[model samples]
Target: MRIIILNNFFSGTAYYCFKFREYRLFWIAAFFSNIGMWSLVYGRLWLMRTLTESEIFLGLVLTANLTPILFFSLFGGILSDKHNRLTILRITRLFFAIFTLITGILIHLDLIEPIYVIALSIITGTLLAIDIPARSAMIARIIPKEHLPNGIILYSIIFGGSAIIGPLIFAPIVSVLSIEYLFYLIGFCYFFTVLILLKMNLRLHISKLEKKISYSRSLIEGFGYIKTQKNILYIIILGVIVGLFSSSFEILLPVFTDEVFLGDSRVYSTILLLLGSGGLVGTVILSISGNHFNKLSVLIFSSICLGLLFVIFSRITNLNIALMIVPFIGLVNVWKGTINTTVIQTLVEENFRGRTMSLQQWSWGSAALGGLFTGFFAESFSSPFTLLISGILIIFFSISIGILLLSLFSKIK
Candidate 1:
């Protein structure tokens, strides 16, 4: 009776992965942990904007967080494949808790600076290079193959829900206590994640699929799969484009709330809340539909939509219209991600899944480079102009490279 109720509550395949005890608990823990992490991130952005009042510093913080992943995630993926994923996850989360608490202490002492914040982001990024792949690979270990899509979709909802809930939760706390408390709260969340990770029992090992190979060989093998699989390569490339250009929208958000909307942190929080709400809705709809979509075609169409939305949002002068448009932007973004991630998860073999996902993350991390460009252009010109040009680039890439890749993909199949 309870099983039936749970299934109905989650809706459709969303509950398929939840039938597993490990996934159910992991889902809950990941949700709250992400909320804490994202709230900390939002708080950091607010703090950076307070300190520097420069778009560059805002983008720099993101760059520091992502750049390490771009360079180091492959090694992390290899480690995930070779080591115990749960152990890696637990260790990283523990360090994250410690580091965040220390940062909070610094801030509480009024000793925190922009450089310190950037340094902490760099450390977190390095940890994520390992943590993300191990964490993602663990999902495959715990869930059955037939229900991977359900796991992926439901897992994504954690993030979508967190994105909304995080800032909303942060606003009141930071407003009442201070930014340091937000960091302190984030530290507690990571500690909780570490605790939950320790309780997970994953004796299953996919690493046995590959014999003891040299580190270089393993790295080459992962890259080899991507090189040979032209379609997957196409998807990764397209993701790079999306990450690079669409990212400017976020990089400019603090600027938008300040200069464009003429408001403060509350306004910034409201925009994040709307964006996250749209993402949550989009993920839920996908989950209910059983991820039944033409993966390739929908991916392309969503890319075009994202590019168009970025252009529209940047050009519009009306605050109300812009606010209305932000949600749509969030919707398209999550849909593209859900389809892309599910397709990759389905196609890649278990052994290569960690590496492939790490690469996918690396492409997404190009947002750092995007942020750099965004900050540069916004500082040199105007935020609107920066975003307008970025939108045009996304459209150009989607139409040009996207079409060429699709043509090749169809012919090969």
Candidate 2:
């Protein structure tokens, strides 16, 4: 076991360095952005708990952040097409940094309240709704088209790297130092990210703004494009399924920690770390593989593999087994990062890249909207049963989508 683990760890590390050297500036900027993001999320959740001491409030706060994406992401996409993505990112990052700093000061002054937090979250969400599309689309500008798959993988590594580092540092620092100070730390990360971004000479890929269409038609056009492109829709549907059910591992894992492992906060943290480590490994694999395979087939197979792993994870009662599978969960996420985004970007024209990405984000927004609520039910009822059901649903849904796409492909051929 030790030998296997060491081998995987070394391999993951080697891949990260090789791929990271490809986009030095964006890679550094991504690391900073993810650190800030992780800090903000940890601070936000902790702040809510400090204010209200209610799980319901925690759920509500998450919902508030997600709600705007469900509604306004389309507009975000439209804006991405019409403007310079770098400029959009710079403006939003500046505001986001300021907001983080102000929130820290408010909390330190004991002026914090649920309303303030919720309102701040809403404002942050509005910025994120715009920022995400620009950020995702900016990948094409940063790396060579042939290396886009590697870019996606490296992006995932940064994401998972943040996941590994963020919470590990986050929980302890806040508990020992002050939660208010954590916000300040996040603000610093963002400001540093802005500095890093300013130095990069990214050739802005701007799509021409066509004749003004009604807002409804603009949105309809994004959907219409996907509808005609069966492969794209297939990827989107699989994304939604994975987002909804297969990816609920974090929510469901606490039960495994408590009931199976008979563990506390310490054990929970360990599991989370293992999961993050797994993700890092997965990202490295995808980064090295680059774009050697059919991305669509990779997506379908990885989804099924992820679902099966979840099913196995749901049934396991032993800590040893849980630890072993943690990396596989991360592996699935790496698969998700590479295939999902690459497929979408390849399918869409530069003009609609933003909106199309935004439409893709809707799957996430909708999933979060649903998952948080369902989680409450799972807690109230039985967690193990809830996890089992969710895992099974993911397996069936993803496979069915894959089959449908396969049949469609056959007909076209």
Best by lDDT: 1
- Candidate 1 lDDT over 71-179, as tens digits, reads 9899998988888777787788899899999989998899999999999989988998988888777777778888888888889998789989876876687677888
TM of each candidate vs. truth: 0.95, 0.84
Compared with the true structure, the alpha-carbon lDDT of candidate 2 equals: 0.73
Question: Any idea how many clashes model 2 has?
Answer: 1
Clashing pairs in 2: 278-327
Candidate 1: worst 10 consecutive residues by lDDT? 202-211
lDDT tens per residue, model 2, 1-413:
99888767545432333343326777788798888886675467657756764444555566667678878888888778767777788788888899999999999899999888878888888888898888888777766665565566667778778778876876566667878888898898899988888876645455565747666677788788778887777777778667776535654554466667887545666676777787777776767665556767777788888778877877888898888888887778667756788778876776678888987876566655644754575556655666677777777887899889778767877
True-structure lDDT of candidate 1: 0.83
What's the lDDT for residue 344 in model 1?
Answer: 79
For candidate 1, what is the TM-score? 0.95
Ten-residue stretch with the least lDDT total in model 2: 13-22
Off by over 4 Å in 1: 1-12, 209-211
